[model samples]
Target: MSRIEPPSTDPVNSKPARAATGDGLDPGGRRRARRYDPDRKTRILDAALDVLAEHGAAGTTHRRIAASAGVPLGSITYHFATLIDLRAQAFARYVEQQSAVFEELLEVVRTREEFVEILVDLVHGGPARYRSAVLGFELHLAALRSPDLRVLTQAWTRDSRAALARFTGPDVAARLDALLKGMIMNVLLATDPEPREATRAAIVQTLGPADGSRP
Candidate 1:
């Protein structure tokens, strides 16, 4: 029997295979990269929120979010199948956070002064808080295009209006929610140097009764 020579082993390139695990590409030799962790999903989602808020839904791509989160591009899809999936999750988180904050504010809101003050504070933020009011509106506009988003948005509106109705009447509360939404859109687009007074006045007028007393 002819002696079989062991197949000549060619050493991997000294530079190290660019296709290795740390190279960001997935395990199947595909160029798509991925990160491994449940936390990574949340991190990517949060990063996507920041990117989307900064650049709008049109600007929110997997690559952008991965770069922001310092993760691999494929990691986004590992957690979310489509951009809409990510956007839906991000919007859900956004609404949840806003609800929690507003609930806190509502706890102490006895008069229009306090209510408006808290609302403005939450909207405007302190010098140190992340101020992305425009970005928030961008997300809202993006969500309006999707049915899944509409459900969440409507639920959020219904819950909030119901809460407000506890203070104002149901009719007034529903109207107040609509009025506030319009005011928010205006605030996002307005160039006025000081619209707080006008905004506050609008809120007060909506909450106050016809003769400044409950019916």
Candidate 2:
């Protein structure tokens, strides 16, 4: 059963006695309708993502997510059938959000140098967040074990590479995507990162001089 929160009291006290809850009628054994919140599910999913980023999939629980979301435990069961279901939906939401982040990185690139610099910044940790990396790592690990998650992973990879392929072509974009992932992981784990110039040089080396060459 859900906990009924007590309503606020007025500064001046009245002669008449009042019920603890203003949520519904108290006397005469009256029943009340459930409260409505249109955005509760979205908030739950967002909270689940936050949980996933902070803790791995294994550590994410319905109670944990409910507490993070400030929703009731019943809400978790109401929205998702199982923990795996909730985790999978949360992972999907992360991918959707990250797709936008990835697209924003390439939105203003009109030159090879601009692209190279963006890649360099990415390699050197520009807009990327520790939380994003943690979520990505958890998603990848989960996908490895579940074929269902692999579908989402594959689609994300395809879209990400396609975005890059707009500038670097399919072949180089694939390699660059792989390189970027590796370099990001290296940067995340390294005690001290290499010079920013080294990152730029690596990107420039990957792209080669601008020839407007067609594959």
Candidate 3:
């Protein structure tokens, strides 16, 4: 019988193969690792809000948020260096999205009655109202303890007041802002929530007639 030839061991003829692990270098010397996700930062910020809404700021952490975000733990730090930074960005996003919703709703209101109806709908019922209510309280409470967060809250208040000022004038808009805040809190927390009509009346009372006449 002829002797069987051993397999060739020549590196020059061998096919290129990737590293089993580590840096994932291929035989051709190129890295074969997964490409970085461009939207990972936004995902992390959104996940941070979901975590905050569910667990409050105290319960939000890199590991928990990483799992929630479906990202590597390192990605959290890669996007936001500190928990406070993550919270701030998440809250900023929340405020921006909420403001956009308000703008959309307010844009279609041609009269004071329509504006009151919109505010009533916002407090009594609307999309994501309850979830936003919870997150709003979480952010407000967190801001109490964080001066940096308080700045964001103040900015949010200024924006809301500015939006209301378009209809209520600056003086009434400030009071209306306060009224809306209180009404929202009551609607979210009270065992017997105020009726939509009652809320509307309260708004009208605070801001006077929505018929263009200043209160």
Candidate 4:
């Protein structure tokens, strides 16, 4: 039998292959360090929303979200310690995003008619918007069972009322908030959402006049 050759010492081939650091692997067959993504948290949060929309709060889990987010499982725990924490943060993000849109819509309202038109358009903004509305409802239902989530809901309501109060007075703003919630639910559940004119009429009845008065 040929004598067993000692390990190759050739400079090109004799070097023992470096062991992987267990960090990650690039496509080129070289080991790579785990990349840090500054926006990873944001991605995870958004993924959480998609998961929430697809699977109700009861079905959402860290593993499911991590898979959806394409993040390592530990990342979820790294950012949020518990499911409640994740839900709270995700809902907070959703509220902030929706509030920005609400503020933008309010910014363009120069007259009561325009305000009514905006409200009507919002109700009829279509399926994509309806998904967000559904998500909102999901969060609301969850908030009922979670004081932590209720805090977020409370802040959202306060901010929404404050935004509406910019054009309508505090009293009308409060009523309008309630009206909006009901109208949105009706719009989402109805086979055919109520007509813009019908929504307009409701607004007119509720606010009396959107004459840009903030009491």
Against the reference, the lDDT scores of all candidates come to 0.63, 0.75, 0.76, 0.77
Question: What would the per-residue lDDT of candidate 1 be over residues 1-215, giving only the tens digit for each residue?
Answer: 11111122123321211221435555776765333466887788779778887788887777788799987665666666566666677776666665565666688876656766766655455432343455556656865764446655665676678667766779888988887766666655568633677777777787774444432
Model 4: residue 92 alpha-carbon error in angstroms = 0.9
Model 2 misplaced regions, further than 4 Å: 1-32, 126-128, 213-215
Give Cα distance to truth, residue 106, candidate 4, Å.
0.9
For 1-215, candidate 3 gives per-residue lDDT tens digits of: 11112122234433333222434456888856756699998899889889998899999887888899998666676566466667778888888777777778888988767888888888887658988878888989987877566766776777788888888888988998888889889987799988887987888898774454632
**Clashing residue pairs in candidate 4 (N, C-alpha, C atoms within 3 angstroms):** 169-215
Instruction: Give the alpha carbon lDDT tens digit for every residue of 45-108 in model 4.
Output: 8999999998989999888898999987767776765666676678888888887888887887
Spell out the clash pairs found in candidate 2: none
Displacement of residue 142 (Cα, Å) in model 2 is 0.9
Position 109, candidate 3: lDDT = 83
How many backbone clashes does every candidate have?
0, 0, 0, 1
The alpha-carbon deviation from the true structure for residue 204 of candidate 1, after best TM-score superposition, in angstroms, is 1.8
List TM-scores for all candidates, in order.
Answer: 0.73, 0.81, 0.81, 0.80
Ranked by lDDT, the better of candidates 2 and 4 is 4
Candidate 1 clash pair list: none
Q: In model 4, where do residues sit more than 4 Å from their true spots?
A: 1-33, 210-215
TM-score of 3: 0.81
Q: Per-residue CA lDDT of candidate 2, range 92-189, in tens?
A: 77877777778898898887778888888776764447678778878889988765677667767887898899898888889888888888788878
Q: Which window of 10 residues has the lowest lDDT sum in candidate 2?
A: 1-10
